[model samples]
Target: MNASELQDIIAWMIDGARSAPTPPQMMAECSERLVRAGLPIWRVGVFVRTLHPEIYGRSFFWTHGGRVETGTVDHKILDSPEFAVSPLAPVFRQGVEVRARFDDPASARFPIVEDLRAEGATDYVAVPLINTDGFVNASTWTTRQPGGFTEEQLSAIRSIAVPLARYIEIVTLRRTASLLLDTYVGNRAGEKILGGQIRRGHADTMDAAIWLSDLRGFTALSDRLPAETVVEILNLYFDCQVSAIRANGGEVLKFMGDGLLAVFPVDDYVGDEAEVCSRVLEAARESRAGVKALQFPNGDDVERFRFGVALHLGRVLYGNIGGGDRLDFTCIGPAVNLAARLEKIASRLGRTVVASERFAGICDGGWSDLGEFPVAGFSRAARVYGLHDEISAAAN
Candidate 1:
């Protein structure tokens, strides 16, 4: 390829990188452009490490046939033999490039080289992309040319490596931030924060079906069981509740020790009060059943697990709240307070699930009135209701 042609291709890549194109798009564009510039490129792969809890890194692949594919490498893969022996591994660890001539069978030290040779590839080049932070990523190219990549082709690949690394670093950082926010905070809250709601006093009021739940005898269990066992049981218990709530379209707001707070926004359902209330009730029922089915891994505890759930519908302040520089994105209001109070009442009344009068008024399912009770932090006593006998029995 001529210098002018290579310059044009590099310009195109810089434009794409500046515009924040996704990794896959960037890989495909660069590969296609190189092939069009008289390089015998058949496949291109770009891999970068990312900051994520569940994922170790990401890989983007582009083929000669215009197909793009992506794969996520788990943290466990770093210990695997395949990664240890791969060309990119040395590029990252040794801070050097790896060039293999697949046409020479004796040069095929890695298993991947043999596979590439079988696919009619003659040359493979893996370049180390060093970031400003001294981290090394890798971008590899494969060619089907009988003799291998020409000098000009290799030079072109080398020239684009730095800028490509810069682009991918930006993209990966953005993705890492997003994943961390979503993982630590609820999705709705994360979006709000990402959308410039960082001010400590920022808040929005919305109507929602509030849910509160806590495991029965959790305090006693923690005291009796080993600390590790208590943690295991807590995780298992929360898994049941969280899965059920999320499956029923509820966003878990916060986990407070043995208890949790969640909500199903009525506004999200177009103010469908009945539907929102029913979802919260259904989630509660499912959570109860799930807890009943859980069998502790160890035989040390044979007692059945139990919990109390309460549902209420009301308007809540949904946003940041706390002292300056330290805030929590969660719901707060009388509705949230009432849900917690009713959860305690559920335990006292020997009922697994309880619903506020406001929630029951909109729900279509049968509920048995549990009568009025004096609630803390409120002027008047609040009326609570429990699920019908048949439904409660079936849940048990």
Candidate 2:
């Protein structure tokens, strides 16, 4: 490619960087521009690290006349042999450019080069991209030109590497923040935080179906099981609750040891109270059934894991709360308190699912009254109800 064409591509990349396009879009555009500049490019790949619990980073791939393809690399992938021998690992770790001429016999050392050679690729070049924070990533390009890349084509690739890295870094950091927020907080809460509802006492009162649940005899189980076994059991227990709640359109807000708090916002109600209540009850029943199906890996004669779920419907203040520097985004109100109290009541009453009078009043299914019970932090006793045999049987 000529210098004028390269300059035009560079200008496009600089403008694209400022526009904040997504990683895949940026890669696809860059690849198309490079090809249009007469570089004989056949394939392009980009990889960047991110802050995530399960994912270590993302990879983008673009082929001539093909749409961009992306894949996530799990954190565990770094330990695998596949990453150890790949060109990306060396480029990232050594912070240098790696060039492989598949046409040369010496390039057979890397299996990826051999694979490219089989695919009619003659040259491969991987460049290390260093972010402002001093972290390293990699971008690679391959060509099928008969004699590989000319001096001008190689220079074009080198010149565009910096701006490409800058644009990718911007998109990557944004994605990393979003993924961390969504993973730690629920999606709805994450959106609120990102939308700038972050000040202390920044809150809104909204009606919701409050859910509180915890394992029965978890303290005893923890004492009896090994530390690792206890952790495994807790993870299994939480999986059940999270799956059920999320499947029913509820957001899990916080986890307090063996207990979890979630809610389904009712918004303006609009005569949908019964529908909301039914969803909460269905989630409660599904969670109960899910936990009951868990099998301990150790085959010890221990009692099966059991749970107590409490459902209540009322207004709650949902927002950031805490000291100046550190804050927790969660819900707090009488409804939340009552749901927690009912969870304990369910355990005491030997019922798997318990509902407060307010929730039962709106529920579409039958419920059996469990009489009034004095609950902590309340002025008067609350009437709690349990699912009727017919409803329970159908749920099971």
Candidate 3:
């Protein structure tokens, strides 16, 4: 590895590498480029600390013959014993490079070193890639070449470390912003905000299948349980609803106490009315089963939780709305309110799932007319329908 070769690699790190779309793809390409440039690399990885609620960081691993493996480290793993002995532990904590020669028994006594040895790796090196914010990210390079990597090969890899850090930092920052936005707000909303739709009145109207659901007796349940226990119950309840909704192409918008609001956006051109409406109904059924099966080891107040869902299909206004500096990205329309009222009616009728006339008409069979009622905010009585099987189960 000559100075000219190292310079060429650095030039690519600064220019050509950034052309890759994502960090994981960029890492895989970088590894391939290095291998083509005469580096005896086996397994290489890049790990960056990220700002996220459930994840501590993200990782991209590239092996000589394997596909690029992307993974995440959860916050819980930061305190795990496995992470304590990994080479990254020292590199990130001390901002120093760690090298272990597997051929030498006296090398660093990390479990990862032994694992690499078993996998035919003779050398392992973990280097710190410090971001502009002074936060330390990490990268690891391993070689299965006989007697490990030569000093020139190691230095050549290190020569590009600075530019590599800069490139990685840029990509990581973009990813962090996306992860945080997607975590706090839903994906659809995050994309809107990212696309510069941050104004208070900028809105998008779409024909959508609206879903509104709530726990049957959440207030009484909260009153009876400890605050922490109540919150735990709420988490469990939402987990059931969120999973079902996302699985069925529904975007969860907001969680107001025990109530959840989500929508299945229909295609404006081709129109996915039947598809979207059926999916929303399927999601409601799945959510109901999930809540019913919620298990509490104590056999306490949460042994058999019950919930109700109201499905409606109509056009909704989705955008930012608030006063002054603070705003909320939400959906609002007569459709949403009608769904809310149907949810209350579902409670009164002892039905697990109810749907407005429009939603019921889009969906196939299995719905029974629950009759018309004088809805609060409307001029005329609104007709509602309930799932026939659920009504029979209630009677039983």
State which candidate has the highest TM-score. 2
Q: TM-score for model 3? A: 0.89
Q: Write the per-residue lDDT of candidate 1 for residues 1-396, one digit (tens) a residue.
A: 767777876786666554425667767777777677787889899888888888888888898987789998899988999988888888988879999987676566788998888889899999998888888889899999879998888988899897788777777777777887777777788888989999987999999999999888888888877999999899999999998888888898898989999989987544488887888888888888899898664455467788888889999999999997899889899889888899988887767888899899899778888789999999999998887853443335
Worst 10 residues of 2 by lDDT: 387-396
Residue-wise lDDT of candidate 3 within 331-357, one digit each (tens)? 999999999999988888888899999
What's the lDDT for candidate 2? 0.85
lDDT of 2 by residue, 222-308 (tens): 786799989988999999989889888799999998999998988564337788888888898888888889867545564577788
Better of 1 and 3 by TM-score: 1
Residue pairs in steric clash, candidate 1? none
lDDT over C-alpha atoms for residue 203 of model 1: 96
Better of 1 and 2 by lDDT: 2
Ranked candidates (lDDT, high to low):
3, 2, 1
Per-candidate TM equals 0.90, 0.92, 0.89
